[model samples]
Each structure stands twice: as structure tokens, then as C-alpha cells.
Target chain A: MNKYISIILLLTLLLLPLVIYEDNNSRYEKLSKSLLCPVCQGETLFDSPSEYADDMRSVLKEQIDNGMSDKQIMDYWTARFGERINTNPQNSNYFLILFPIIFGLVFGVLFYKKVSND
Target chain B: MISSIGIILTWFGFLNLILMCFSNKKNLFQTLVRINLFIHFLLFCLLEVGLFLDDFSLYYIANHSASSTPPMYKFASLWGSLDGSILLWNLVLSIYFYVYVKFYRATTELYDIKIFAMIILFFNGFTIFSSSPFSGCIQLASIGCQDFTLLPFQDLVLSEFGRGPNPLLQNHPLMAIHPPILYFGYIGLVLPFVIATSELFNRYKNENWIKIAEKATYFPWVFLTAGISLGAAWSYEVLGWGGYWAWDPVENVSFIPWLLATAFLHSSKTQIKEKTLINWNYVLACLMFLSVIFGTFITRSGVLISVHAFSNGNIGTYLLIGLLIFTFLFMYIGIKNIEYFKTSRKVENIFGRSGFFVANNIILSASALIVLIGTIYPIFYESFFSRQLTVGRSFYDILVGPLLLILLYLMVFSTKIAKVNMNLKKWIIENQNELNISLIISIFLTIYYRASYKFVLTIFGSVLLIIIIGKNVISKYKKTKLQGSYWTGQISHLGIGIFAIGLVLNVTQSFSNELIISTGDTVNFGEKEFIILSPYEEIKEEKNVINLPIKFNDKEKNASLNIFKNSSQQAISSPAVFRNIQSDTYITIKVIDDDKFKLIFRENYGIFILWLGLAISSSSFLTRVRK
Candidate 1:
């Protein structure tokens, strides 16, 4: 029985992410949070209360209804306001993303070897 | 006249620090250090008096304070700006140095004391020469001031009143304590670094230095935890964002030191037990100190775009130079003393307590490293490629999130592991009942909440940790009396568990909506009805407030907008929250016209648990401090 319960739990965990889908409202929230406010320093559109942010939200809603993909919308903003508009670094900067992973892996291996050898 | 006296006292304090660095006589060194501390205390008091007296002769006070400011904010205005914040930093550093000299100096090597004094002297000199809070407009101009005009003394008097503190700062009381507590945490880190460096320079026979370093780390670690949490609380209350952390550059910089120091604390524990990771602890200590300076530089330099950044100044260049010098110095000393710590032992079992600590250190250090890189990568990218970018909340949420989950999972089993034995299979068998119960409950919660896989895993880890810790505490109490350290450690871990659960629930369940409504209008939002009452405006002191009363499901709350009557003309929205144990209903108003208003309503679940967890975790540290 315990083994059966464990298998069921494992299956549930694996299937959960696939079942979770973002609706339009959540998509709007996520997209707004991922974009920086053009007029505010270091604040996202979701957090900024300026008129500019309000206008941006309207534009975002229009784009979402126009069925623009998340990447396309991000690209549109990036092209309009340069790369700084998006809060996340662009996919072109793969080196920036990989640096932390490599750091963690190398450090983890060295630590494991040093500890296990003795 | 008061400004000149303050400057003279600062210079005198600097000179005294210089003399103490070179003094061979212990008595003279102690006396000089104490006098330096006294001078800084006096200087701080003078700044306070100037703020209260509305002394326009002092440029900092004239710029950051006003006659209309409250008494608490008047005191907070000391650290409200760039120059004055550095002065506060110097004062806190002086107090730390004096405490070290009076209590811990006899056991510490003279070289260590001198090195520490020299560091303090450098900062003292930086304040006096580069960023003196006592300087007038002319003196400030002489040091390359660009943010403000260099007005004559008569022009300052013509203004008649100073500009008050930043509107956001004066909006909340947390501003008064957060910076000072964070400064104490930042300055407290210098001692461990000094101790580690001294140990590296002179090979100590006993491991007493490790104990000293560990004990010294506790209060600072506690303070940093409380400070960071309080900062998040301040953001939640004052920023009107309905969220606590935004992964902003300033917030990330402060968090990096806390993460590194936490890593050091964990590793230091294993070092005390197994006499291993000595070199690693030394490196971690040095890195913590470096990160503090780097954080300060990032916060004050304006190299990155942050709402919390000071204006761009020459101080950034000086700080970068200081960072480079110390990096090279620590490298040289670390390499020179590499052979001294070669006799340390290795972990006998990978599943033992020490081994788990190693895992903890690696995970924490990696988290810190990732945060550090993410924070500064934009600057490096911009300078090198001339392309502007930002590393925001998504980056950290993606990279560091799994590491934290893994750390939490490790916490469950690591607590169950015995000191010297490995029997992992046997241990699992013994705790199978607790494990099964935790798994069942987490699965049920996951299904009920319809949470995603990441949150489901987080829930499992948190539940398992709490159950195991609870079981352990119960069994331990049944067997024998638990020690204070043991209880505190378990309580802190339990706090982490609760905090993790609260964070997951908050992220997954929170919802917000915006609506435009007029006074006496009713609105319905997602099964909840809101009745808007009359809107009123009032003037208090220097602020013009517009208050909108609303009844949400039988609870009356007021959401207001405050406009400060000052030169900046800043307007802040004050959010009204209907607090409960389960969730908070928050509302904030933005005036569109005389009749219509835009209100943002946010419902955040389990936020109080986050605060409670933070309080329990941080307050537990108070009892863990060693004499």
C-alpha cells in the first residue's frame, strides 16, 4: 500500500505542471510584471501607478487581445524602448544565463571531491 | 559655526584613528579608539541638534530636513541622504571598533587590531575628506558636488525653510530603524573578516579563533535577517505595491551579504565540530566583508538604476578602488597562509552532519553568487557592450528558487542525521510514519490548491520539514531536556518552513484588480461586494490627504492619497488593509477627478504568516548569542 501511494504521489507531481495553464488575466499580470515602467526607475509596470504605466497597461491589453505571443510583445517593447524595457535579459545573452550554472556546477564538484576524498 | 565644529571633530576623530593604528602601547591605543568613538558620538548628536534646530548652515540638514518634519523623521534625516548616511556608517563603525578594543582586544593579536584600525581609518578618512556631512555648499563644491547648486550662506537663509525628508521615507516609521539596523549588520561583519585575515597572517595553534568568529557572526546574522525582513515590511507598507520583495538592485545587494554570512555561519559550525572547512570559512568571511562594501558601493554609486540609489558621485570611484585593493590584499594573504590550514580533517561520512553542512554551504554560496552576478551583470553588460538590460525578479525566481527547495529538502534529513553515524536507510525506516504523513498532507494540499509542480514540491518540503522537526522536538523532550541552542535552532528551522509555505501560498493565491468608482457607488468583484462611502479631504501639517471610505463585506476601511506640500510635490498612496489570519484585503486610491477615483484592490493570502515566520526566526537569534 505504501509503495502504491508513493507511485501515485510521484505521478501527481510529474503531471501537475502540465495541468497548470495561465489564463488571460494571469498572462497579463505576468507580462506586466516582466516589463519595466519606462518613466519610473527600477519599477515594473505592475507596480508603477503613473499615467504612463496605465497607458502601457492599455496597450498591453490591446496586444493580448490581438493575440500577440509573449515573445512578440516583449520584442515589440524592446524595439520601441530598447532592450532595457524588458526586466529579464534577452535570450541573446546566453552567456549571462550560463555563467551562474557553470559556477554552481564547478563549485559543487570541487566541494564534493574535497569532502569525499578525505 | 556648528558646521565648522562638526567638521573639526570629524577631523580630530580621523587623526585619532590614524594614531591608534600605529600606537604600540595598548593603553594609548585603547584610549585613542575610545576618544574616536566619543568624537563620532558627539558629531552624531550635533547633527541631530542641527536637524532639530533647522540649521540651514549645514548643507545636509538644509537639504534633507525641514521645520515641518516630525521629531522621529528629524532623527531619521541623519541617514536620509548620501553624505549623512556615510556619517552614520562611520559612527556605527566607530562603535563596533570601540567594542572590539574594549572587550576582545587582549586575546586578539596586535597585527589584527592594527589592520582593523587601519580599515576603520580609511572609512573615517573617506567621510572627512570625500563626503563630510558637516560641509557647506562651498566646501561640498570643492569635493566635486554636482547634484545641487553651491549657494552662498545668505541664499540658504533666504530660503527660510529646509526641504523635508524624502516623502516615501517620512511616510512610514520603519524608515527610522531599518537603515541603522542594516548598518550595524554591515559594520559588524568587519570583525570576522579581520579575525580571519589575522589568523591567515599568523598561524594560530588553537581553533579558538573559529569560535570567536562564529560567536561574532551570530548577532550580525540576526540583525541582517531582521533588517532585511524589516526592509521587506517597509516596502510592503510604503511602496503601495502590495508586494514585499521586488529583487531590486538595492534589495539584492543587501540580500547577498546576508546569504554569504549565512553560508559562513553554517560552515563555521561544521568547522568547530570537525576542524574542517577552515580555509573555506576564512574565504567566506572575507567574501562577506567584500560583499558588504560592494553592496554599499552599488547602493551609493548610482552605477545602476535603483529608486534607492544616491545621486551619482565621485564616491563610486573611490569605493571601487577600495574594493580592488582589498580583493588583492585578501588574495595575497589567503595564498600565503594556504599551507597553514592544510592539517584540517575531511568528512568521514557523506551522510553525516558535517557533510550536510557542506551541502548547505555550497547551496547558499551558489545562491549568493547567482544573486551577485544577476545584480551586476547589467552594469558589466552595459559598460562592455553598450547595451542596456535588467536582471529582475524572474531571473532570481527561476535560478535561486530550486536551490532553496533543495536546501529545504536537505534540512529535513539533515536534522534527522546523527552526529557521527551514516545509517541513512535505517533512519528513513525509523521516520517512515512521519514521512508518509507529511507526503499525504502535502499531496492533499497540492490537489486542493491546484498548485503547479514547483509549488507542490515546495509544499512537500515545507510540510516534511515541519513534521520532522516537530517530531524531533517531541521525542527529544521526552528523552531529556533540550538545550537552548538546540531549541533555538529547531525554532529557526521551523520558522523557515513556515515562511516557505507562506511564500508559496502568497505567490500562488494572491489576486488583484483595478476599478474606477465614484463616491457612494457600489461595485462587485469576484463574489465580493464593495460599497463606497463618502470621500473627504483633510490637511494635516504639510500633507493634503484625500480619504475614501469603503465597506468591503462588512469591514470599514479607508484608502487615502497623501500629497506633501513641499518643493518636490510628491504624492503617495496609502493602502488600507483589512487584516486577518487567513488573508489581507488591501485597497489604495488614485484620484482621477473630484468625483471619480481609481482603486486597486489586492487580496494576499498568508502574508501574516510570512511576517510571523520572520519574527520567530529573527527573534530566536537573540537567545543564541554567546557571551
Candidate 2:
């Protein structure tokens, strides 16, 4: 039971970074930079000066000032611009994040078992 | 006229390769292929001449060249765009084909050579049809265009120059060699795959085939290692972002193949020990080549957005078709030869050398899978949902980071494991003294430096690991004549350790911030002082280039950084780095106006160790070829 709880706790801690809210300017800048600017050829929101990027920036600042959380702001944009605005796949496509770890562990065990059986 | 010769030669080369594939006169066909390779080389020479002559009649030269451009840049411009870049790729591929035929033809299977010849023909056909540098110029009136003016084409023969290479391409000298070296690595991958697949077709049991494949793997592996290092170096120097890798799609695509190839190398070793991994070897070989093709498709597809990806159309579909055909064909072979994969002998110990390789491959393949999924997710999202969902760096970091840590753990401990059973307690008991000493040292250093507890743990682990491996290597070197492969593996593992240490230090201990400063302002960033001397502006053609001279950490030498406002009126910051053995002080300036500028100051502690590690690892591949 303790082992299971520890595993659960570790997983929650890993997911914490995804859920944590940013209240500072640097974090905001980093977040904005990761978001793609749809109007530009190949540029992030922070790097582009396209009208859409400018509008998105305005929205970001507006939400931040209004005490809106990061997820709230992200979802707001997702709703407005469709899933295209969600730069990184989030809650809906979390399996992509989990697949590698699970595969690694499974393969590690199978390989270890095969090697150990003399 | 000269450019047309390149096309004619390329067509003839393709014809010769086809003939070589079909004909019974093998020696005659091989000689013809060699001669055709010469023609390919000559064709590239003519193309270079056309570029140098500023021949506007050649469409590629007119678009990518200028009379006023420096001689070095004009030559480098050969790969600045799509058509010319394709031509360069073909040149490198032909060169590799020539070398392979001339040297390895005697020992290598004929089927391998024939298949390779066919691959060469396919690439030749693609180059000719999709991106032909020989196509006539859009503006033929300005033939022999040359000039000293900014807009020289307006004045015809007196002043008829083309636009210079892209500002981004011309910014660094590394641009000239980086692409070609990378292409060499990418195209060199074709040989091993063709050989491995040919084995499936012939069912030939030649012992020399594996040796041939190993040779093919090592040389290209060296080039790929060098190419990746050069790319990271280029990014560190050129991209003002102050980061070497961003987990960008294009970066991920290139990395996937390298990972697969790494796995292939290990599995190939497994085949030597047990011969069980033969089928896995073929699969990996196919995947490595397919991943290269996938990388090519991604870069040219325009399906995903990346700063470094090429802008092209229809080529992606053609490449996708080629990929599908090859993948299905390889799949068919794999299924037919399914029984060959099973081994009669079982692994005696889980902690043996072969066992270590199995674990290593597991991590490698998993990591490759992670990268592949992360890279392809956006494409899938876009295709299925008609939504542009980007897989951010955080996703990759979360997915790949722990796996790398596991890999590092396995790497450090594998040496010990190779000599023991799966008894962790016994292993720890034997090495406890050295481990404790290293652990204490790491703890003290971490505390002294005010690093995080996690960092302390990582440092402790790496130090303990390194000490154990280093001690073993030193003792081995003293006892016996050092085996080339053994030493190379040790060096490469050491490189991995060093790189991990650098990455940990840079990520956890670095300090960075942006400040808007004016002349004579001394800004304190972390522990270092940056003094902005003065800002000056100069007009280079249509762009206003702003220069900032900075005194870093009270150093006597001042480095001047250039910032330019391009035609789009966006300020582009070019960072100047003061590289030292221990650390690097990086600074980038963005022009706010004449007197004021936005300065990004970053001090990365021990980041040089990362490059040092990469260099050490890359050079180790050379040792394999030494004898």
C-alpha cells in the first residue's frame, strides 16, 4: 500500500509542472515564446510581429491582468482559435507523454528477464 | 550551357546505374558507374564555375548570387536555396557511391551495390525533376549579370547582379561546411541499409557481409556524430537564443536516425556474441534509412512549421511514396525471415556485457520512439483533427529526460555489471569506499556552490560513476595493450558523462535576464558585471546595423555585437559569446533606438564541457577505423 502511494505521489509530482501557475514575467515570456504564431511563416508568438500575434499578445496580457490562470488563458485561446492555438498538446493528448515511459519500463524488464535466464 | 551539362550528366549517370543493375557484364557496368560518378563531380565543378562567373543565364546562380558578394560567400551560396542545395546533396551522394564502388566492390555483395546504384538513381531522378539547378533563368535578358550596385539587375550588363544569400545563411562561416558534412552523414546511411536489405533478397551467407556492414556503419557514424556536434556548435554561436537545442521538429528528426543507428551498432555487437539479433539488426538498419527519408520528408513537407525547415511542395508526397514502398518491402522481407531472428543460446547472466547491450538498446529504442512520436504528433494532430497542435520542448523534456538519466545510470554501471551478476548489493559493497568518498565530495561541492539537492544527487551519481569507470579503464590500460574498440567505447561513455554534467550545471546554475540599457551603464547580471560602452549605427544596403561594444566581467577585451533591423523592420539580435574553459558569457543586443538597446545577458557555467564531451565522443569513431 505504501509503495503504491509513493508511486502515485511521484506521478503527481511529475504532473505538477504541467499544472503549476506562473505569476511572473519571465515565466510568462517563456510560455509566450513556446506558442506558435499562426500568421507567421515560421515564428513563435514572441518572435513574430504579425497582426494575429499582436492580438494574441494583447489577449495574454489582458488575461494575466485579470488574474486568469495559465490553463484558463490557454483554454480561452484554444476555444477562440480552435486547437491550433494550443502550441503543446495538453490534457487531451496526454497519452503521447506517457507512452515512452511505459514502453521503456516494459522493454527494460523483458530485456533484463531474457538476459538473466541462463 | 555549363549548368545544362550537369543535368545531362545526371541523366546519363542514372542510365548507367540502371544498366549496371540489369546487365550481366558486371565489371563493364561498374566501370561505367565510376565514370558516371566522375561526370557528376565534373558537373558540380561546372555549377561552381557558373556560380563564380555570376552567370545569370543559370537560374540558381542569378537568384542566389551577387557580384558584390564576397568570393567565399558566393561559393557557399551554392547550398543557400532549394535547387542548389539538392544539387549539393546529389554531389555528396555521388562521391560516396564512387568511393564505395572503387574500394569495397571486391568484398561486398553484388546485390548490395546494385541496390545502392538504384538508390543513387532514385535520388538523381528526384533532384532532376523536383529541383533542377540547370533549369533556365526566369529573366534571360540579364544573362551574364554582374554589378557593383545594391539593385544591380536594373542596369543590365553594366550592373546586373543578383541578391546575395540569406542574411541568416551568410552570418556564420560554419554554414559553408555544416550542411555538406551533415548531408554526407545522412546519405552515407543509405549504404548499410541497402546492404542489409540486399541480404534479405539473396539469403547469401557470406561472413564478410557483416564486416562490410560494420565498416559502413562506423564511418558514417563518425560523420553523423561530427555533424550533430557542428550543428549544436552552430546553434550555440549563431542563434541568439542562448540555447544549443530547442527539441525542434527538424532537430528531433535528425536525432531519431542517430538514435536508431546507435541501437543498430549495439545490436550488431549482440549479433557477434549470440547471432540472435540478426533480424533486429536488419530492422534497425531499415529504420535508420527510413528515418533519414522521413527527416527529408519532414524538412521539405511544409506540413510542420520550423525555423530551419525548407519551404517546398510536392516533394514531400514523392518522398512519402518512396518511404512507403521501401517500408513495405522491408516489412515483407522481415516477415519472410522471421525464423532467423530466434537464437539457440540463452544469455547466461543479466549483468553480462551482452546483457548491458540489451539494456542499452532498450533505452535507445525507447528514446528514439519517444522522439519519433513527439516529432510526428503535430503532423497527426493536424491531419486528423485539422488542428495545429505543437509538441513543445517541455513534452520532450518530460518524456526523454528520465530516459537519458536511466541511460546514464546504465552507462556508468554497465562496466561493473559486465563483470558481475544482477546483484546490486554485492556491487555496492565492493565499491562502497570510492562511492562514499565521491558522494561526500559531491555533496560538499554542491553545498559550497549552493546548488539544489537534486543537483547534488546527480553530481554524486555522475562522480561515483565516473570514478568507477575511470579506475577500471586506467587499470585495464596498464595491464594490457589497449584495444581500439575498448578505448573508444570508454572515451565515448566518458563523453556522455561529461555532457550530462555540463547539461546539469548549465540548466541549474545558469543565470540570465534582459535589461534595457544605454551607454556607459554597468549592469550587474548574477555575479558578473556588464558595461555597455556605446551604440553605433551603420547603413548596410537597406538595413540599419546597430553595433554595441560591451566590456564583460571587467575584461580588458571588449566584444562588439551587431544588431540589424531587417526589411521587415524587426530587430534581430546577434549575440557575442566570450568562451572560456570554465564558463561562457553570452550577450545579445536588440536595438530599441540609437542610444538605447535591449541586452540579453547570460552566464552559462561549464557549458563548454558539453561540446568537449561531444568532440571526445565523435573522435572515438575514428579509432575504430585506425587499423
Q: Model 1 - which docking category?
A: medium
Q: Looking at model 2, how many pairs of residues clash? A: 0
**Each candidate: RMSD to true structure?**
3.1, 5.9
Evaluated at residue B61, the lDDT of candidate 1 is 77
Give the interface RMSD of each candidate.
2.5, 8.1
Which regions of candidate 1 deviate over 4 angstroms? A1-25, A90-92, B103-108, B138-159, B418-420, B475-482, B625-627
The count of backbone overlaps in candidate 1 is 0
TM-score of chain A of 2: 0.59
Model 2 segments more than 4 A misplaced: A1-34, A37-68, A72-88, A99-118, B102-109, B139-159, B343-346, B417-423, B452-454, B478-483, B538-544, B553-571, B625-627
Task: Give the number of the best model, judged by TM-score.
Answer: 1
Candidates' C-alpha lDDT = 0.79, 0.68
Error at B468, model 1, angstroms? 1.6
Please tell me the interface RMSD, in Å, for model 2: 8.1
lDDT of 2 by residue, B335-375 (tens): 77666555424555546667677777888888888888778
